[model samples]
Target: MRPFNFEKVNSGAEASAAKSQNKQFVAGGTNLVDLMKKNITQPDILIDITKALSNTIEHQNKGVTIGAMASNTKVATDKKILRDFPLLAKAILAGASPQIRNMASSAGNLLQRTRCPYFYDVTMPCNKRKPNSGCSAIEGENRMSAVAGYNNQCVAVHPSDFCVGLSA
Candidate 1:
């Protein structure tokens, strides 16, 4: 693990101003922190957005407004989100096992790294991990690779079955 600087800012303005060249907004570091520890992600500044401006599910106009920081479990279990936006609910349910969904957020889920085993191991050469690294999954264990919308470079399938169901 590498030694890095850490601090907490109170307001949105302060947080935005604190953004450095390598600074990243971290909300529910369920994924980012792990990558950092694994030496996959290295950031100079980590602005924790666990509690900042907006972090709640709201219904103001016609449709629903899903805050980036709202927990996936809450959205998956919320009557309103489930009833109105089953797509969102289904997506959440299909993601990150039950434990991860409980701690992950919608925005974070959208940005979660690929589940390709090759990608997980930093030592392995993966196009997604290192652009033009020459895809290994193409000729490797492709059963777990994509069943649709996959090309030669990367054949890894998206693990989110919920995303598929939610689209319908």
Candidate 2:
């Protein structure tokens, strides 16, 4: 991973205020860390938002509020979540491993990047990684590419089971 400056903030406003030219907000560091390791992303600044965000699952009159920093495991295992959003619970439980679910935040899951092989492989051509570089998945191996709402430029899809559950 490339060397970068780090900052820890205590609120969403603080995180937003600290955003630099090439800054990324990191909470669980689940997806972002892997991308960083692969050199897929090279942010100049990493704002640690773990402390700034709430992890609690709050019960409200209309519905439950899940904190952006709430872990997938916490959302999956929460009494109210399990009772109210079983599909979401199941989706979260089905993703990654126990350790990953324990660290993957709900907001991070929603904001996670594509799982396209072309996008991950730095040596490969990917429009998402580099605009107008050409999309390898269009003519190359595309088993994991999107089935709908795709163009010639890209066929990448966001691989998040939690987001699918959330949609329903």
> Which model scores highest in lDDT?
2
As for candidate 2, its clashing pairs are none
Per-model TM against the reference: 0.82, 0.93
Clashes of each: 1, 0
Top model by TM-score, which number?
2
So what's the TM-score on candidate 2?
Answer: 0.93
The CA lDDT at 123 in model 2 is 94
lDDT of model 1 at position 56: 83
Model 2 lDDT on a 0 to 1 scale: 0.88
The Cα local distance difference test for each model comes to 0.74, 0.88
Deviation from native of the Cα of residue 158 in model 1, angstroms: 5.0
Q: For candidate 1, write residues 35-96 as lDDT tens digits.
A: 88888878887887667646688975567777777777887888987778788787678656
Instruction: Estimate, for each residue in 9-118, the C-alpha lDDT of model 2 and write its tens digit.
Output: 99889988998789999988899998999999999989999999889999877689999899999999999888888999998898779999988999999999875877
